[model samples]
Target: MSRAKGNLAEDKACKFLDENGFMIIERNFYSRFGEIDIIATKDEVLHFVEVKSGLDYESAIQNITPQKLSRLLRTGDVYMKKNSLDVDFMYDAIIVTPQDVELVDNITI
Candidate 1:
């Protein structure tokens, strides 16, 4: 998808997360490995979120391939180490569709 559309979906995802009690820490954090679409904190756990959007949930979710997940994991590690963070963290994905935004937590590579 285009960057504009991706940004829009990320915006929606951020709103959803904020409304659900997550504090937005950052957006579009980039490292040599990859970009994390959103970073937030909830219940003292840091979340590295990937935003994916399509006409439907399955189509959007399919975009998170194994390689992409690996990139996310590496990027998340970079973020934590750079910030000297030792707290609990997890990888997650926010699927944005026309009808809804869904958060899938604890994604593993």
Candidate 2:
């Protein structure tokens, strides 16, 4: 998808997360490895979120391949180190579709 589309999707994802009681800390955080779409916190645990949008949930989720996960890990490490954060964190994904949006937490490689 295009950059604009990605931004739109991320906006929606942010709103969704907000409604679900998450505090958004950052958006479009960058590092040499890649970008972490959103950083949020809830119940004292930090969440690194990846926003993926497509015609369907499967297609969007499929975009998060192993390589992408690797980059997220590396970028997340960079974020934590740069900010001197020492909190519990987990990888997550928000799948955005025309029908609905879903949050998948605790994603693992």
Candidate 3:
């Protein structure tokens, strides 16, 4: 999607996360590896979130290809290292659709 659309989705995802008790620590963090859409914390665990939005769930979710996941993981590592953070963390995805937004935590393969 375009940059504007991506920003909008990330904004919505931030709102959703904030409402659900995730403190928004950062947004659009970048590194040599790639960019992390959102960095949030809840229950003492950091979440590196990827925000994907489309007309439906499948289209949005399919955007998170393996290459993308690899980039996210690498970037998350870079973030932790750069910040000297040794806390627990996990990769996550926020699926935004016209009807609703859902947060899938600990989205491991």
Model 1: per-residue Cα lDDT over 47-93, one tens digit each: 99999999999999999999999999999999999999999999999
Query: Stretches of candidate 3 above 4 Å error?
Result: none
Which regions in candidate 1 have their CA more than 4 angstroms from the true location? Answer: none
State the TM-score for model 3. 0.97
* lDDT for each candidate structure: 0.95, 0.96, 0.94
Model 3 lDDT tens row, 1-109: 8999999899999999999999999999999888999999999999999999999999999999999999999999999999999999999999999999999887776
- List ranges where model 2 is wrong by over 4 Å: none
Candidate number with greatest lDDT? 2
lDDT of 3 at 1: 83
- Arranged by lDDT with the best first, the candidates are 2, 1, 3
* Pairs clashing within candidate 2: none
For model 2, how does the per-residue alpha-carbon lDDT over 1-109 read when each residue is reduced to its tens digit?
Answer: 8999999999999999999999999999999899999999999999999999999999999999999999999999999999999999999999999999999988884
Question: RMSD of candidate 1 to the true fold?
Answer: 0.8
Q: What TM-score, over all chains together, does every model reach?
A: 0.98, 0.98, 0.97
TM-score computed on alpha carbons, candidate 1: 0.98
RMSD of 2: 0.7
Provide the clash count, candidate 2.
0
